[model samples]
Target: MNRFQAMAQIMAILCEGDRIRKGSQKYKIARKLIAAKIDRMGPEAAYSKAKWNKYELFVEIEELLKAEKAGKILRNYI
Candidate 1:
């Protein structure tokens, strides 16, 4: 199996494990973190490839990664 094969979409993005742009990586404390993939993104007709304004990324990843799957990935992205 490939690396992301076992990881939740949100988990892989979190552990992109590399340096990334500001908005995609870190965020302000008050605002809830979110991850979404844009498709045909350059046009006004573009839409989300991955659920947006939904994942709500968190700080604690270890716990969340173990328990994350199905529709529960969001609540546990911590």
Candidate 2:
């Protein structure tokens, strides 16, 4: 995968790991670090793409977990 995709995957994995460990604060800290890295990279589209990728990845993982929880509820009722 390309740099942006790689970063997204890395961030997604980190987010999932944090969730497993019940580390909400750490996850927020990681997001801030990602934002800072993006800022340090400069205000170009190329740099911004990585930042966006990280945000999207976080959202995707969060949605996945939500869906999983919903599925579990459905399974219990069905």
Candidate 3:
């Protein structure tokens, strides 16, 4: 699959809410990261026609986990 599709799938799987509640700060953080990556790679139109480079554009699942953990900690402080 292409980067966009892969990204969507990954987000769907990992996005089980943050440390606190559903659709909390972690969800927003994940969405922002996804959006930024998509924007960096151009636009949605390119996702379909763009040549696959062994699925390189998508963020690693572990990274998202780490982001969620960090966000949780930050949320506790804030």
TM-score winner between 1 and 3, please give it. 3
Once model 1 is optimally superposed onto the true structure by TM-score, how far is the C-alpha of residue 54 displaced, in angstroms?
A: 6.7
Best-fitting candidate, measured by TM-score? 3
After aligning candidate 2 to the native by TM-score, how far in Å is the CA of 10 from where it should be? 4.8
Local accuracy of candidate 1 as per-residue lDDT tens digits, 6-63:
2244334444544223344233211222222221232121112222422343333323
Instruction: Give the C-alpha lDDT of model 3.
Output: 0.47
TM-score of 2: 0.33
Residue 40 displacement (Å), model 2 = 0.7
Query: All candidates' TM-scores?
Result: 0.19, 0.33, 0.36
What is the C-alpha local distance difference test score of each model? 0.31, 0.48, 0.47
Q: What are the C-alpha RMSDs, in order, of all predicted structures?
A: 11.9, 11.2, 8.4
Best of the two (1, 2) by lDDT: 2
How well is each residue in 1-78 modelled by candidate 3, as lDDT tens digits? 566674565456444343223366555655555555556654453343223422332343235557566664433321
TM-score, ranked from best to worst: 3, 2, 1
TM-score of 1: 0.19
Per-prediction backbone clash count: 2, 0, 0
Q: How many Å off is the CA of 59 in candidate 3?
A: 9.6
The count of backbone overlaps in candidate 3 is 0
Between which residue pairs do clashes occur in model 1?
A: 60-78, 61-78
